[model samples]
Target: MRILFFDTKTYDKESFEKQTGNYPAIEIDYLKTDLTPKTATLAKGYDAVCAFVSSDVGSDTMDALHEAGVKLVLMRCAGFNNVDLEKAAAYGIKVMRVPGYSPEAVAEHAMALALTANRRIHKAYVKVRENDFSLGGLMGMNFYQKTAGIVGTGKIGAAMAKICRGFGMKVIAYDVYQNPELADFVEYVTLDELLASSDLISLHCPLMDNTYHLINRETIAKMKDGVILVNTSRGGLVKTDDLIEGIRARKFFGVGLDVYEEETKNVFEDRSDEILEHSTTARLLSFPNVMITSHQGFFTEEALAAICKTTLDNAVAFEKGERNGNEVEERQ
Candidate 1:
């Protein structure tokens, strides 16, 4: 079996070799290029294709991979929003993904972003570099005794709630699927209740039909003034225009984003000196109260290892025609 890995990063190599070595019969080829229609031609004669986030898999790319005799696509990340599932199904491409590799990695990054934005840490680091030690306009709120409403109580949301509880904050959560583990201290409340009562509203849901642009005008109107919002999940979950307006009106005191809605063609790579043409992103970066990270919630060493091991395992299992739980999600 010949397995091809696209968009391979430096951190993924060690774990991939370690995991794939268990199945010595399979040969793996790793590449840093992403899987697009043009790049899909590189998968010729491969039994399976392994990919990371930001790799596009639309109908054209799927057709190309199918023509190359690739039968399976293994996604290292949880969100398959980047892949065209209907096209994959039409082309007889079975998709598998590592659903919940390490929620703690993302939940921890959400806290890091929120705290950095709330306390002006990013600005402080810049000032210290310039030898400015004054603390003018650096005031921030006390996170303790505040209320945090987590929109999705999945493993990641539950982890965030636990951290908030550790800081002496009340934790309220809302999810379409209820988690019995969080029934002790967290209340599964309505979205309206969460918006109105929460001092900090953090989103941890997947990007889906109902969740796309869930935080638009109507929902933002329900939120309290000076509410801080953080999105470490998918970028499509929040409306960029609404978020910008919320910041302008001072309704959204701060925003910590690990994902931007239009970051697919750009981010996770580099554009340091190039002029950023994305208007919404440019405006978002211009705000003093907002912070944006390049969808790096899963960049930790531990998560990278887990992602590769699971992804390679998914490919090996599929090749053996074994039942793989990672491919269990219902395709769109």
Candidate 2:
């Protein structure tokens, strides 16, 4: 099988190339360009096309891939919100994704962001570099006895809950389906209750219609004053404008974001010399209490290795024409 990988980076090529021995029959090619409608024809004669988080797999791209005789669409990441599933179904293309690839990596990054923001570690480092460490604005509260609200109870969210429990904090969660494994330690509550009571809120849910902009102005109003918020999930899960307003009103004590809405054209590229066109991102950066990462929550070594292996496994399963849990099918 021949697979063309889009939006290839140094780490992606390194990790995928390191695992070539696992799939000897497969020939993989990497391209630095993204998979858009104009670039979809580049996959001609390839058996499948591999994509990343920022690749555009819309209807036009799907049609182009179908015309190119590509049968499989393999996403190396967990979320599928970038792809149009109905269009893929109509084009007779099978979609597969690597879900739950080291959820601990993301959960751990979420904690890192929370800690860095709360303790102002980044600022302290800058201050100490100039020999001005007087500990004037570094008073951070303890996590013990604080209430942490988790937005999802999936593998990543559950992992975050465990970490919060270890810190001696009260853990409450809200999910459409309750995770029985976490029932003993986590108290499943309504979204309103979680929003009203949590001192710290972390989001780990998938991006869908119901979850798109889940944290908007209305929901932000419901949250407690000076609440710390962390988002390691999809960018669309939180409305950036509302978040900016919340920060302007002094609503959040600290905000850590691994993802943002307008990151597609900015995240993987080097635009440090140019001005950021997105005003919302610029405004968020202006706040001293906010910390934003370039969507590197799943950039750990273990997660990359697992993603490479699962992507190969998913491709192998698709080649066999076997039904697997990774396949995203059309709803009847």
Candidate 3:
């Protein structure tokens, strides 16, 4: 089973190579080029192609992969929103992903972002480096006794709820399907109620048609004044322009985003040398209260190992004509 791995980074190569020895039947070739329509032809001799969250797997790329004799698409990450599942299915290609690989890693990063942004730690660090620690605008509120609203109640959201509880916060969640494990401490509320009541709101939902732009102008207007917003999930969940308006209107005390609508162009890449003339990311960075990280919420060591193992397991399962329960289809 020859697999071509696209969008290869140093960390990705290191992680995947460390686990390849465990799957001797599967041989992988790494490529730094991203999986686009043009690069899809590189998978001509491979049985499968491994991709990450940032790789493009649209209709054209799917067609190229099918023509190149690629049978399977292995998403090393959980989200398959980038993959055109319907097109892949139409081309007789199977898709699989590593779902819930170290949920705590992302959950912890969400909390870190919230804390860092809220307390102005990034600013403080810079000021201290310049020997100008006057502490003129480092004021921050306590999270204790505050309300934390979680937008999703999956594994990562559940873990975030636990962390919020540990901070002595009143945890409320708004999800279509509630996790029963949170019944004891967490309160399930309506989306409107959560937006109006929560002092801190963290988004952890998938980006689907209904969930696309979930946080926009209307929703931002519903939030409480001086609310802290954190998003560690998919980028499309929050409308970037509306968020900028909210920031300008002083609706947010701070904003921490691991993912944003325009992140695809800058994710895992250093654009410091390039001129970002019309970049929304550059505009977002101009704000002092907005803290954006590369899409690295799931970059922990444990998560990387789990992702590699699951990707290989998916490949082995497909080769043996079996389902490992990670198979993604058009209906999924």
Per-residue lDDT over 88-173 for candidate 1, one digit per residue giving the tens place of the 0 to 100 score: 77777889999888899999999998898889788888888999999974678999999999999998999999988998999998
TM-score of 3: 0.99
Winning model by TM-score: 3
Residue 128, candidate 1: C-alpha displacement in angstroms: 1.6
Ten-residue region with minimum lDDT total, candidate 3: 323-332
Backbone clashes in model 3, listed as residue pairs: none
- The reply for model 2, stretches above 4 Å from the true place, is none
Per-model C-alpha lDDT, please? Answer: 0.86, 0.93, 0.94
Better of 2 and 3 by lDDT: 3
lDDT of 3 at 309: 90
- The regions of model 1 sitting more than 4 angstroms off are 328-332
lDDT of 2 by residue, 220-265 (tens): 9999998999999999999999999999999999999999998888
**Tens-place lDDT digits, model 3, residues 1-332:** 99999999999899988989989898999999999999999999999999988999999999999999999999998999999999988889999999889999999999999998899999999999999979877888999999999999999999999999999999999999989999999999999999999999999999899999999999999999999999999989999999999999999999999999888888899888999888998888888888899988998999999998999999999999998899988875
Worst lDDT window (10 residues) for model 2? Answer: 274-283
- In candidate 1, list every pair of residues with a backbone clash: none
